[model samples]
Target: METKILPRILIGAPGSGSGKTTVVCGILQALINKGLNIVSFKCGPDYIDPMFHKEALGLESRNLDLFFNDKETINYLLAKNSKEADLAVIEGVMGYYDGLAGKSYEASSYDLARSTKTPSVLIIDCKGKSVSILAEIKGFMELESDSNIKAVILNRISPMIFEEIKKLIEETLPIEVLGFMPMIKECSLESRHLGLVTAQEVGNLETILDTLAKQVSESIDLDKLIRIAKTASKIEFIKPTIACGERVRIGVAKDKAFCFYYQDNLDLLSEFGAEICYFSPLEDKKLPENLQGLYFGGGYPELYLKELEKNDSMKQNIKDALSAGTPCMAECGGFMYLHEVVKDKLGHAYKMVGTIEGESFYADKLVRFGYIDMEAEKTNLLCEEGMHLKGHEFHYWDSTNSGDCFHAQKPLRKMNWKCVIGNENLYAGYPHVHFYSNIKSAERFVDICRKRKTKI
Candidate 1:
């Protein structure tokens, strides 16, 4: 097996609000300021952290999710994205050990670290406590035999207190204290219903990132951080071979209204010889010309119903394109857009492209959330009979046309439910799929596009 030696560290927290993102943003910008190439990765399914990383370093961040992919795929993606980079900083999910139902380590940051053989630096929030912080850090360090936690970053601590805490921790425990942040309110990022607001929404993100870099560089020890990252073992895995079809053009909806897409999924589509032309459903008048297929991933379509409804040309064009036999894949919010109408909060109904014969009503609460292994109940646009694909669904809306072409089942259990709403040319559902889970799923879509290239 071939191996690649990449210096990396998984930045994790005891839990959410441990200042992990702030510290990560600081470290990323500091490294970038030193003229180093940094590849940023988010451990779980959350897309918001990666947005901050990209905003800080001007580089596209990627995600490594264990729920949607196996360890081999994780290593392949990590190595593929971190190639030739000076350092790889992986920002972890909620807590160090939180995953699935908060009882398993299936998709936790600890799982990511152990699977990829990368060391971790645990971030501890040291507010309103002193010696108890040591207990917190020590407990986390010794929780699992292979904790992968090599160092600690104390948040909301002064230099003098940090020195005392560092002295006590290093003396009593085998862990190293890397740095401490003195709780700067200006360094914080705001959040919303989904999570942190997308990086693009923060108008002064560049300025904020520069300030964070300065603060982190002043507080953290970059030399020790780099040394720890360099200690990561060489990763051994075979990168999956992607089968490419004849070149085909596909339209992808990407905008404020529809932006939840994995970087790997898009890259895999390109690797399979699909020219992905990105357009906006909220602003664009029509789909890209001469397209063989279309992809509309999960996003906040309900938030911009008025804008989407006002764009009559766009809605009619999309409906016409699908009717013309162009293969389409819509997930979550995208699925909502294909309905006759989408009723948002406050009981306002907005007209949508009536591809599916139903309406999507927002239900204030998550209809069905979490990981699932999808088995095609019947052959459709992206899969054949009994084809299994790993994905997850997290949406607040329900459609009257959740197609019965597939049955999505829990990974560690026997529970399953019929989903998706389409035939051989379309597959619309609430679940967001990661293409890396099954290469054939993407290849099949590309093949369909290739076959329909001449007719369109």
Candidate 2:
């Protein structure tokens, strides 16, 4: 067992839209301004919020999901990423106690805090009530044996009553009232069908971040926050083992059209000896030379149909590679890009790679949205027959011929369905897989890439 003393604090909310992301970002930038080396983390499988941390603020942000990884891995990931940083800021998902299916606390933020032994700060939305706020905090603290909540931050409250509520809460509850954040209208982030629009889409992103940092520095107590973060104990974990095998070059599609990738997934591949070469299908004219494998993750392909269709050479490049038996793995939006045609919300069709015989169109609503456990019905690139894995599906698009290579069942629900189009060299489907859920699948993919490279 390995142990590391990590100074960390988790920002959790009673539920979503309590301004968790905005608060975390504000605190992160303010800390960075104070010459503190800060590393950020998101609790669950969100790919976008981490982008805000990485792209917008230029800080290294990683995901720590209890659903995809065990406690040991979570601790290892936290310790591994926070090695050179002064503080680690974790932003919780959905709600503090809300976890899988809204029934169990299996993968909740509280679960994560206990597993990693990190201190927590609860941020309550103080819009509608006053004295009732203390009841909410007390209930959360007593709901579980150990809530791990150390402090509180009130959001969307007026400055006039800040001290009034702060004093009342400190007098009533066992937790310390950190500070309050007044609603800054222009600094708020805009949302589309998915959560916040990608950090790149916001026109005034830099200005908004600057405004948030300035506001947070003035409103929030940085000294108290730092003191709480430093109180976190040491984390104990088992180091992961990796195979130092043959090296393989894999071309990964990364751009505005296809940017949904877990940093851990790519890191695991590299740890297993695959040199990832990133290329943009949106701008690149051709695939990288001598690629052993191709990976296209999920992103906003539907929004940029015209631009993707205009890149005729890149589409043909991908189609030709897939046809030649190059190993490939694609999820949600990436699966849509392989279709013969993709229709936007207005029903306008645009040509795509034509690897799949059907077209992808917006479903108007989320289809099969949640966590899923998958069992492969036949042998495929990443697994053998009857093998099981964990993944997630959160997309608003559907394909005309969504394949039936795997049987998927939603956790805690009686629903089961058929999906995926798996073969010896391809695993294209709507379910986004975290490689750590079953590291063997990741290792298998790396081995396949190595074999392909050897043949060439």
Best by TM-score: 2
lDDT of 1 by residue, 279-312 (tens): 9998889888889999998878888899999999
Error of 2 at 441 (Å): 1.0
lDDT of 2 by residue, 1-456 (tens): 988987999999999888887778888888998999999999998898887789888999999999888898899999998878999999999889999888989889999999988899988889987999999999999998778999999989999998999999888878898888898876765243136367766788788778888888898898999999989988898887888698899999999889999998999999998899999998889999999999999998987899999999999999999999999999999999999999999999999999988999889999999889899997787888888888999999998888898899988889889999999899999999988888888899989888888777
> What TM-score, computed on C-alpha atoms, does each candidate reach?
0.96, 0.97
Provide the lowest-lDDT 10-residue window in model 2: 188-197
Q: What's the true lDDT of residue 4 in model 2? A: 90
The worst-scoring run of ten residues by lDDT in candidate 1 lies at 189-198
RMSD of 2: 1.4
Model 2 ranges with Cα > 4 A deviation: 190-196
Error of 1 at 330 (Å): 0.5
Clashing pairs in 1: 403-420, 403-421
